[model samples]
Target: MASNIPSSAGRNRLAAPATPGAATTTTPSRRALSADPTSARLSASARRPGGAATPHARAAIRAIDQRRRTLFTPGRTRRRSLRDQRETPRDILRNLSRVLAPASQPLPSSSSSSPHRDANDNTLATVPEDDDDDFLIERPRFSLPLQEDEDDSDLKVPRSSGLEDENYTAHSIELPRRAWSEGPSRLGRESMASVRFSDYAGPEIQSDDVGIDSALFPPPAIEEEDSGNVMLGVGDSPERLDVEESRRQTLGRESLFGPIEIPDMGNETTFLMAPADSPTREATVIDAAVENDEPGVFDDMDDDHVNEPMDFPESDDEDNDNMEVPNDAENGNIEEPDATTLSKPMALATNRGKRRKLGKKISKHGIEYPSLPPGVVKRLATTFAKTSGVGKTKISADTLDVIMQATDWFFEQLGDDLSAYARHAGRKTIDESDMITLMRRQRQTSASTTPFSLAQRYLPRELLQELRMPVPVPIRASKKKSRAVDAEDDVDVT
Candidate 1:
């Protein structure tokens, strides 16, 4: 059986492969034993009994505590101080000296010898033995810096009947000297306040056999009186020292947040109470006509929509009389604004936005409404001007169509009249003679002294100016003397 036991070299706890009729014992490894949290190496020293873990501890220990919670809040119930356990305020005050005394301090030896005598028994004995109830401890004032040799033998005890001053110092530490206040922080520069812990840090005490070394705690560095930083004197209390400011300390609006801006509340502007969605001049005039109750009251106003018919509400004459504006009839009446005047401001204010939206729509969608192509009339007008011997002529958009109509009619009449005159003279087309005869007839009909003067109305000014030269007088048969006389003589001779 022993031969079948596994060796400890491989740290394995299983039995080794056994021969026939062989047996073995396998000892558990240290790691396998330590797998239990109750093992001596795994358990904390506090949990182990006698600072050592035993087998019985394994029964209660777990790898992770089953009852462990993330949050922990201990109970606040307390045994309370002896002073708090006392019944009355005067009783608590009567025993304050005993409560503050350390446990090591011996109890007061009373006149009646009792080792277990408490504060109440000591107070009762003191009251009967002595009638004087006044205290003995006198608090030393801050008239001078505490000397180097000074210790807690100084501070006055608050109460005294039971506890003695011997071996019972209220506080062990003594007050620091004025020079000892100088530290790494700006201690002396600031007023007595709720200061940092570092500001209170100063030189540590030297060897107890000797006293504090003055070299370790140096005097405060001298500051200029003109620099305005003040430090209290050794004898003076900080509460009584008054610090004078060079300038008044005040929080100013301009100083803290730069400058505050107050809005212009009383600014002048047109305020309209009425709501008008569409802003157009025609609507303004229409509103006026309605307010005045006259269909044509604002008809004289110049507007593009002036010719567009308006549908005025048909009212009886009695209603019109009732609606008549009272401002015209009564001398004492203060005029209330009519609807038209009220709408004027709103219409004017929204007019710019409407125009902007209109321009935006036209630009974005490229004029989707029914309309001629852009600049078509302009190009035609330019072409006509160029053809009529006036290339620099700039036509007005309002009068361009009218000018075109007049031009077409004028040319048609001139062409048909000239063609008729040519046909009457046995010709198919016009010659210079026809033009001269036409101009002479036009000049006579128009009562113009100059020949072809009416041609100026039809032709461009530049062309007519160039054609204003004198015409060659023709030698007519009526003007010829002998040549025309031969016609009379020839008729007589025949």
Candidate 2:
């Protein structure tokens, strides 16, 4: 048995070597081979079997593919099918009827031709139910007069109250009766003639219900003699009417005439209205005088005194002649005392000292004489005294200087008025009260001239209070340092 017989294992080994390129030349067994053919065929079919479908499946697939292709195509039957499917069932039924029904059964006629027809004539016409019965009840008709008469019969008549029982004559009736007696009356013949004229003038003559004559009414009339022209009411000529209307417009209705009374020509003491020719006469006479007289005819009228040079202390012969004295000098030069020493004296002699100093300084300096009258000087002195206080002492140099300058200015301004007052009243001194009044008058004049600047300059505390002008709130001093100190103390304590 061992003599040259190959085992099944050796046969397998030899078969495996025969197919060298296939997985190390492993050959399958007969049974494995038999099983693999059907599996391979199945695997091949699963992977890529082109003609393996059943007839029914292939038909279904074909149908689906045909439907997809048709659906994708433009203007295709499938798109038309989709549109037919989307149509309403009623439309479908309608289409079906058209297709299936006999030609003898015609479609409905249009609704516009028949008033009672619906959109489709096949629909029945709708009717509204009567609703008047719910809202309206039956009522018997009766005449208002009959109803009122019946009511009057049943109801008692009320007696009149005595409050309104007195007879009331209308204003119109009283007006005619009252007015007829006021004006001049015409004779009966004249009245009859006027009435006859009215008939020719217009229509029938009829009085108002209140007995007012129609002739009295202001209305236009047709003139029989002058048919071409229309006549206005009596007393109304065209020119007169136009003038009256113009007057009414220019002067208001109440003032139809010019001003009834003229205004008073005030205070003719100083002012006079010269005769119209007087000015010409005066001018001619003045011209004649000027022509007759020399060019310097009024040279002597200049009474203004020239200022003379002030005289200084004579130290040498040359200096004495050169030291010119002012012409209007009243006193010699007085040394200006020390400011501190002069304070009390200055306060006591504020008015007198101020005037004297100004007068002496002006005189010594040979300044032009201020023709200050005695009254103005007294007024300025009094004003200074009043403002500085009567008994209060210790005056400042600045205040004294201001007083002196102000006094000088005041005399210069009111020189003419002061001269008149002094000449008329025979007064030599001006007082503080007078000065204050003059200052107040000046302030009033200045305020009128320059309101805004005056307001700013004179914004005193009293004025501010009266005007309720707001005062700024004072800010508190900073407490930051104190707070810091307190914080430092706290830190130290802690």
Candidate 3:
């Protein structure tokens, strides 16, 4: 059990608070404290009928309160200066542009006070610099120390190099820079006015050749002759000359059909003109050669005689050249069709120019069935025999036809079955699942290893190589199975 009695040293330590720095008398009890409330005061935590606290309690509590002054106290956040807080992004960008902006030079002697400021340029307000240590974006320039010699200044000085001690000597702590000065802008805002239009082109497009619209059909040479070496002469003569020479236009049946009457013509130009209506055979050109010394001539005519005309048959006699075609059955004895004419519909004869018909027939069910030729069917039968371990065998035409019919019937039944399966699955189109199910049913019905044993057996080697075989269950092979060990000498053992 812990002692409730106060020890002498503890009593002295507890009693020391009665006087300033005095550790003589024992402390008054809690009842004495309550009775003499004016003489001994107690806090709410220490007021439960307890003795007075030790002499150092006030100093210890004071030290603790001093330590907690910062621990529980909220901190003071760093706030931006009033200048930065007031500055907007627009103000910042404008200030930064000064780094690239051309140095302020006195304007040229203009008639007006300001130099050519447009409405847009007028809208841009110049932002004032706050101080030398303004934001970096606002002051992005550096200057060199003033030099005494111009030749030395011409030499390039490396920037941000280790030799700043020589260039910058006065201010040891301050960064090396010339008093701030502006330079020409990199943004090229001065050219903004020119780029506003639609035809603001960049660099001129240059190629080895400018061939637009001129590759295949190159521009015709600007010379006299065309690409072809052909040159043109006069065109067809006009029916009538100008009023000055209106007399030479006469052309009549009398002049054309009359006998060769040569008119005298010397130094005067004359022309032969056909009648406007020329198809009526107004002139007869079939006559023996006749010559006339004096001949009428056109303005372009050569020395003329009555021209010799070749003897040709009369206009009515030319009808025999074109073959007569029978328009109806009543005139069936017309000329035969031309051998070179491939148009069967236009052919008059029934036998000639007919399309070569195939061995096709319509079934009793009104279905058009294409019959296989005897050659193909015989070849297929031979292939089937070859696959069945038989020698090449020629099939009879009747037997080949029967095989073809059976094949056609089998395919017809297969299509019906596949369509029925697709319909059962509520699909108009057949898919692989329906095919697998159909193949399974066929294998079950025929007791064959594959769905279509004959098809698989007779398929070409290339096709069989591409097709994958499907088995109901996978067969696991032994690790040591080799057919070479099973080889046997059936003929003889030597």
Candidate number of the best lDDT: 1
Model 3 C-alpha lDDT per residue in residues 47-146, reported as the tens digit of each score: 2222223323333333333343323222212233333544656447657756545776434533232333332243344325432322223232243332
lDDT of 2: 0.32
Candidate 1: worst-modelled 10 consecutive residues by lDDT: 244-253
What is candidate 2's lDDT per residue for 1-494, written digit by digit as tens? Answer: 35323554464344322211222212222222234321211111211223212222223333433444344332333344345445656456657756765665433432323433322332323223433322133233332221133121233223323234222333113222123222232222101112122121222223211112222332223223222112222223223211212222222211111222111211111111111222133554465456545434333222222432321111122212112222112244433223322352344345434334444322211133533444554555665677787785434556655555665555545754544455455665653224334545667523222322233345666774543342231221123223434555665699
| Candidates 1 and 2, the one with greater lDDT | 1
Candidate 2 wrongly placed segments (more than 4 Å): 1-318, 321-367, 370-392, 419-494
Per model, state how many residue pairs clash: 1, 12, 5
Q: Candidate 2: deviation at residue 37, Å?
A: 99
Model 1 pairs in collision: 1-23
Instruction: Find the candidate with the highest TM-score and give its number.
Output: 3
Total residue pair clashes for candidate 3: 5
Q: For candidate 3, report its TM-score.
A: 0.21
